[model samples]
Target: MTTTTTARPRHDAPAQRARRGSTARRETWGSAALLLLPAVALLLVLRIIPTFAALSEAVPLGSERSPWSNFAYIFSDPSFWNAVRVTLIFSIIVNPLQIALALALAVLLTKRIPAVGLWRTLILLPIAVPQAVSAIIWLVLLRPDGPLNGIATSLGLPTVPWLTDPTWALASIIIVCSWVGVGYWMTFLVTGIKEIPLSLYEASALDGAGSWRQFWSITLPGLRRPLLFVLVADTVSNFLVFAPVRILTRGGPQGGTDLLMYNISERAYTLGDTQAASAATLVLVLIVVAVVTVQFRLLPGRED
Candidate 1:
């Protein structure tokens, strides 16, 4: 009888503890939502709303107006196709080269070397410079009478036109773009490499696996996810490349460096044809989405 009375007195204890746990959970979730709300709101205002508005402008509202008319204008225009071709060529040439250079630099940096911090800082320094500034610097360096051609003349080598010639203008832009982008991409690879478990490397070493073999088996496999992410992001950014073309070449030397963005801007602002520009913009977006979809479908995910 005494033990039963004592057990009955503890009934409120369980209820109080449950209430405290529920309150703690509620507070944690509420705090998380509070922290996330600002960023979510900013994205909605800046990106989501503008994107939808642009799309609406691109497509017609009633049967009297159809987006096809605008699209037809874009498709029939030779310059539009030329710009598309140029953009595709630029992306094709630069993307693989950039990835290769970044991967090589990442591997080299990961090795046991002196002054690693200094090397990393130097590599990353380009990213700190504004894109416009970098383009201007390249423009100066590549000018006909600039340092590059001057060196060529001094060496008694025929001076190759770096930017003025149509043949060389797009190539020059690609070179500058790759130079500016490699460091940023390499940093991602470096981070991914660092995340690989050291135990795997140790085991491979114990098995007398050479550096190349170890990298192919362990490092490459570990880097797959980061590599995919970088490829997707780089592809998207490269497709929309505008700064270098605008500043260095102005899509000049016979429009050899004209990209989709440059073309769209010319239509929207310079030519005063907002509707056509909006339609072109929508098409560009579709192309990027398709490319990304294809990439993901081809790569999917890590096998093991």
Candidate 2:
């Protein structure tokens, strides 16, 4: 004889399922937080701590000076003002010039040219060269009696003072920086150019759009994010340029090339003004921040 047995529901209740999902999410978040803890701790130790320390030391607690004496000293110093001017001039001149040149070079390299790979490699050769070495090479070429002037004299052209004259010294530095920088910036832009869908360009071409029109319509719009990144990074790099100034110019030619970074270094090392130098660094950070903020507003934002 068999007795009828009552059947139990095989599925969990909605509340039970919800509780299980909640528990799973909590565990996942806990594990993720645990994994991120070390990285966050390292960042705090390496960056945040040093930054706060510098800021605090800039206006330290002492009878030696007022609270903002360090900042005031730097702000009032003519040398610091000259550094600001030189740095601003360098950034304004070089950033656009470098980006424009890089874009042109990227387009050229992307075109169908014989031995294009070799040309790209040669252009990128400077990336492998140390900045100091590059600066020294340029220094040798630009020296008064160097090969450049010698060649100019042989050609019956007047010898131009490449590095000695204040008028041309900063421009010389810009040329050196641009030569070294364009290839590196082009690599980024070329990668961006490659990422655009070929169909877009093909369709534009089929529609009778010229290269200039297509560049403005398709290429520029497609490259908004990359261009913004390049602009910001290049701006920061130009503002912080120090090695070439240090190696080749040494901020000389009547202080025509005294960039902010070099000035800070000189103050910190030569004059032993760490506090004032820290103030200068903070000022530089503020300038860069302001510039980047403006750029973000002006440039097209990320893809929606």
Query: For candidate 1, lDDT tens digit of each residue in 1-304?
Result: 1112123334468777687668767777887888899999999999989988987777767859665788888999988998899988988899999999999899999988999868977987887899999999998999999999999999999997898888699999888988889999999999999999999999999999999999899999999899998899999999988888889888888988888899999999889998889888988899999999998987775666
lDDT of 2 by residue, 204-225 (tens): 9999999999989998888888
Pairing residues by index, what is the TM-score of model 2? Answer: 0.87
Off by over 4 Å in 2: 1-41, 62-64
What's the count of clashing pairs in each model shown?
0, 0
Q: Per-model C-alpha lDDT, please?
A: 0.88, 0.89
Q: Best-fitting candidate, measured by TM-score?
A: 2
